[model samples]
Each structure stands twice: as C-alpha cells, then as structure tokens.
Target: MKQSLLLITVVGLLLSSCSVSKSARGQRDLFSGTWSLDNISYENNSGNFKSVIFNDAEDICFEGSEWFFRDNNSTGRYTIAQSTLCNGGDRFFRWSVVEPSQNYSSQLQFKFIDENRKDISGGYGYRLNIVSLTEQAMTLKSNVSVDGQPVTIVYEFSKK
Candidate 1:
C-alpha cells in the first residue's frame, strides 16, 4: 500500500508540471490581438510619426503617417509564417524575434517593395528593432535612411 501511494503522488506531480507548461504556451499566444501606435520619438534625419494597428488575431493591418516628405502616409498588412512575420511577397520584408519578452530584441529586414503595384521592383532596403512586445502592445525602433540622410525613430504602440 505504501509503494502504491508513492507512485500515485509522483504521477500527480508530473501531471501538474505538464499543465503549467501548457499554460505558459497559452500566455505567449496572448499576443494575438489588435493594437495601435500611441507615441513616437525621432532623431537625426528622422522625425516623429504616428499610426494605428488593427490585428485580426492572424494578420496585422497598419495605417500610419511618417514624417518624410512625399511618403508620410502609409498602410500595410503582415502575416505570421512560422515564427517570422512577413509583409507582401517574399521580396517585401520579414522579421523574427530573438527572444520572447515584453522588452525583447528582434531583427527585421526590409525587402523593398514599390509604392505602386506597377513599380513593384523599385525600392530600398532597411532594418528595424522590435524593442518590446506584450499581449496589448509593442514598441519598435529603427534607423532608416530618408533620401541620403540616416535617422533614428522610436515607435510605441498600444492595444486598441
């Protein structure tokens, strides 16, 4: 009777541990939601801008205005493929998080896409930093070139 009780207790402990791990995975999925930009910080050739992000649990829709002349207003959508976030075609852009955290690091590669479908091959490449992420929001920073000048921009977003 004593040995049987010990085995039961060990199995119960293992089951509880497995449940805790499953809960953690569920927490990561909490990032699936809608969010909007709340603030921005600009430096160098970069100027402040704002936008609104609406995510439909799967894809993300973004409507924003930049500080650049002739390219201030923009809109786009991104989809999650595996662990990478992609926009447009394979030639457009993609991003991946290095670690998972509210204040984590990420790498982004800009695949230039044309502003108009007729000129889809005419664009430049760039990079961005995803500084943080949560179920309701995310913060990003990047140094980008406008014309011939490089500038740093910080963007903060919140759930809508």
Candidate 2:
C-alpha cells in the first residue's frame, strides 16, 4: 500500500508541472503576431468623429503609421518605440507595446509609450493608455489629457 501511494503522488506532481508549462506557452502566443489598426473614435471642440483607420504599411516609418481623420481630412502619425526592438533613429525612442499585467494569457492591458514625442499641452512628455488584447485583435483606448482637457480615443488592430 505504501509503494502504491508514492507512485500516485509522483504522477500527480508531473501532471501539475505539465499544466503550468502549457499555460505559459499560451501566454507567449498572445503577443506573437502582426496587428493593424481597424477603427478609431474621438471628440473635439467641433464635435465628434468616428471612423475606420487602416494601417498603411507603405507609410510606416520605424513601425508607426499616420492616423487619418476621415471627416475633417486631417492626419497624424503616432510613433511607438522600445529599447531592444528599435532599429535606429533615436536611442531614447524604441517601438513596442507594454502589457499591464505580467500574466499574458488573461485580458491584456497595453500601453504605447512614445518616448520621442510630447503631448499637445507639452506638460505631459509621453502618451500612456490601456489596451485590450485577444488572439487575433488588439484595441487601444486613450483617456489622455491634452491642453488641460480630457480626450478619449479608441484604436482597434487585428492580426494580418
């Protein structure tokens, strides 16, 4: 009876280890894909604007693209940077997305830190916001202040 009990305990330990390993693998897969912005919405003094934003890869310079405003006919490029991922241009500017929680498998909150640019007011040096992530899609929601006023913008991206 004692030998049988020991064998059962060893098998249980191995199974538990396997389960943890599988979970880690799944989390890594979440960020390992190409993403493109699909939609965006925002409000300004004039009113509000909602439209679809497409990633024009041809215009991408250092992994960033120009955001087009369909209604007013305006455009702006938001640059992203990361230390290790940065190809060149500026050392302080690296392009990458940061996950809020360490556990990547669960709902992910992302922040696009643009160390190279300053906010509209010039008081804030960088842009920070929460992002939603899924297997094939990612959405960035910005509730950042510009010129002492609050502005919200949502950008959705999908896997290529």
Candidate 3:
C-alpha cells in the first residue's frame, strides 16, 4: 500500500507541472477579440518622446478603430468608423505573433491583405514588439520612418 501511495503522489506531481506550463503557452490564443486603441505616443529621431495631434488621414484612420483577431487563424479584420478626414471601412490582414526564443525577442506582425489574401500593407510587413499583454489589454511598440526621420510609436489597446 505504501508503494502504491508513493507512485500516485509522483504521478500527481507530474500532471500538475504539465498543466502549469501548458497554460502559459495558452496565452498565445488569448489575443482573439475586438481591441480598441486607448492612446498612442511617439519617439522622435533623437529618441525623445514626441507628442502627436490627430488631425489628418493618419490620425483619422486610427480614430474609432477596432481590431478583430480570430482564434487559430492569422487573418483578421480592421474596422474604422467614418470621420471628417477618413472614409471608414473594413480591411483584412494577416497577423501573427512571433514566438520568443533564446536568441531573439518576440513581436507582432501584420501583412495587409485583400479579399484574396495578397500582401499589400508593404512588401516587408509591419512588425511591432509587444510591450505587454494581459487578458484585457495589450501594448505594442513600432519604429517607423517618416520623411527621412526615425520615429517610434507606442500603442496601447484595450479589449472592447
């Protein structure tokens, strides 16, 4: 009876350990749902924070925007509402999370696609490092170039 009890305890310990690690990997699937932009900020060429005013096309496109991620698929939809400076519509894209590894950090990538799923956002694709991710919120950092100047954008989003 004592031998059987010891074996049971060891099996129980192994099962519990497996459960814990599997839940961590399950976090990758938690990205599904509609996310709304909470706010955005930028870092200038000098790597200093730069405030932005939303008044043009770029700004309007982000206003009232909603990102919808589907479970178990790399395709998603970006929805925006009509505004004075923008024509709101739905756009499809291919998105995936880069699994972090020993040699490199993880990031989120987006490749704009048409109805047929052809690449369109840019040939190279957009990559943003994930700053934080939780059940209710996510943050991403993107470095971009505008007019020969380097800039970094920080985006905070919350589930809707």
Candidate 4:
C-alpha cells in the first residue's frame, strides 16, 4: 500500500508539471506573430509624465511601432517607424513570459540584444505586467515612478 501511494503521488506531480509547461508553451504560441502597437495610455494620469520609455526612445515613438515575436526561439524585434522626432530603427531582444506567482502577476520580460544575439543592456532588462492577452489583442502595463508617485504606462497591441 505504501509503494502504491508513492507511485500515485509521483505520477501526479509529473502530470502537473507537464501541464504547466504546456500552458506556458501555449501562451508563447499566441505571441508568435507580428503585432502593431496601437495605442499607449497612462493609467495614473499624472501631468508629469516621463517622455522617455525603455531608456531607448520617446514614448510617442512606440505608438505605431511593429513588434515581432518568435515563439520557437524566444527572440523578437521591435521597429520604431512613426515619428520624425524619434530615430527609426529595429531593436532586438530575447523575451519570455514569466509564470505568475502568489505575489506577482504574469509578467513579460525581455532583455535587449544585438544583431549577433549578444546582450547589450549590461544585464539589465524590462518587466511588464501582462494585463490581458487574446488572439487579436494584448495589453501590457509597466509601473514607473514620476516625482515620487507611482504611474502605470499601458501598451496596447493588435496582432497582424
């Protein structure tokens, strides 16, 4: 009876692990496509909004940018092509969806890389809360501090 119980417990643990892996894979598959940044909004709505985002470009530049995600390799690129004020170019990054924990929501994290797949952010990365995701749309929110007040930058995307 003891051996049977142990076997059953082990099998249950293995099956649960497999299901979690499958779920993560499925989420990545949904993100494996070209997406257009449709809109960007502020949740806290502070007048003292930061102009720069990701320390790379102006927040306005990302509104109409293009993002490409490859689920198989966990690689992606984002193109900034909208504003004359912003330098238009492609930025490469390796991305992953972090599974949700008791204290945090499901997060989308990425680190900047070069064309040769080398790290460029000096071991720094960005994490955004995965607010919502669907076949046609996804929304991500990044929390920031401006003048000692918390602010949320919301990014909206549509699959293309």
Best by lDDT: 4
| lDDT per residue as tens, model 2, 3-53 | 999999999998886553444344435545445555555644345533222
Candidates 3 and 4 compared by TM-score, better number: 4
Deviating ranges (above 4 Å) for candidate 2:
1-28, 43-128
Count of backbone clashes for each model? 1, 5, 0, 0
lDDT per residue (tens digit) for residues 1-160 in model 3: 9999999999999988655234334545767888997677776765544343222236436745898887566788877678776677877888877766685456777777888888875665667788788989988887777778878787888988
Which candidate has the top score in TM-score? 4
With candidate 2 superimposed using the best TM-score fit, by how many Å does residue 115's alpha carbon deviate from the native?
Answer: 16
Superposed model 1: Cα runs more than 4 Å off: 1-31, 44-104, 108-126, 145-150
Model with the higher TM-score, candidate 1 or 4 = 4
Sorted by TM-score (best first), the order is: 4, 3, 1, 2
Q: Which lDDT tens digits does candidate 1 get at residues 1-160?
A: 9999999999999988655244334433433444455555667853544322211121222323211111112223233233343242212222122333475344333333434522243444344576666766667787655567776667676765
lDDT of each: 0.44, 0.42, 0.72, 0.89
Residue 79 lDDT (model 1)? 30
**Model 4, range 1-160, lDDT digits (tens) per residue?**
9999999999999988755465667778888999999988888864745469899998888889999999877899999995668999999999998888897788889999999889999999999999888999999999987778778999999999
Deviation (Å) of 61 in candidate 1? 14
TM-score of model 1 (CA atoms) = 0.37
TM-score, every prediction: 0.37, 0.36, 0.68, 0.84
lDDT of 4 at 115: 94
Question: Which should have the higher TM-score, number 2 or number 3?
Answer: 3
User: Against the true structure, candidate 3 has what lDDT?
Assistant: 0.72
> Candidate 3: worst 10 consecutive residues by lDDT?
48-57
Model 2 C-alpha lDDT versus the unseen true structure: 0.42
Model 3 stretches with alpha carbons more than 4 Å out: 1-27, 44-57, 101-104, 118-123, 146-149
